[model samples]
Target: MDTERLFDRSYERVLSHEVDGRAFFEGFYDAFLAASDEVAEKFHDTDMDRQQAMLMKSFYHLLSFYASNNADYYLDRVAISHNRHHINIRPALYDLWLDTLILTVRRFDPECCDETELAWRLVMTPGIVYMKFHYNRDSIVGS
Candidate 1:
């Protein structure tokens, strides 16, 4: 199957009863916070519940960017928000984010394998690239 098809199916499994709603996302955050002190410190004052909610929503936008091959308004806004002038998320942190997410996927998605994990990485790359691209720009494309 194609990358999109593989990712779509596997991602569904991640959200299914086996993993349960919110559990996978919650677990990802837990692992992410412990993955690196930088990550934990970055979110030191964050409201975790709200942050997890945002992450769940952002996953869709990231997939949309991969499927559409364009950073649409929503993704653009996200990139802008994460830009150096705003949240100041460093470029290297995106690598950690992607790695952490994939590992978390492996844990939550029992069906996860090399292909599925690669698909997740491939799918999230565009959005991560877009965010990294805007790290210095600090402005959205059509804004």
Candidate 2:
């Protein structure tokens, strides 16, 4: 099975009205924030409306990056902004982020299974790794 196609199928189900629009993201952030105090503190000043919108766009970039293995303009922007010079997201936080996302997927997607969840992780991990790789390398790359 194609990971991207399968992942997209499951993700679309979670996003559709049947599951409630924005509900998945809301749950993801709620769980993600609650998973760690650092995560909560990082988002304490954030405008979630905007953050969710960004995340909505980001998922596509993640899928795209995974499918193409190329950090396109949008993905590059995401990496640069989150690099050490900017938001400075810790590498350790990504594990919590992915776990929270998969947990939310299980909660929101009625059809979710081990394969479905693995698809999500497989599709999202490259982008997560990209973000983490750029964290300290921002200096050499000129973020």
**TM-score for each model:** 0.91, 0.90
Q: Which stretches of candidate 1 lie over 4 Å from their true place?
A: 17-22
lDDT of 2 at 138: 48
lDDT, candidate 1, 53-81, per-residue tens:
89988988898788888777777888888
Instruction: Give the per-residue lDDT of model 2 (tens digit) for 11-107.
Output: 8888862344458888789889989999899999899989999999998888888888888888888787888789988888888899999999998
Which 10 consecutive residues of model 1 have the lowest summed lDDT? 13-22
Candidate 2, pairs of clashing residues: none
The TM-score measured for candidate 1 stands at: 0.91
Error of 1 at 72 (Å): 2.1
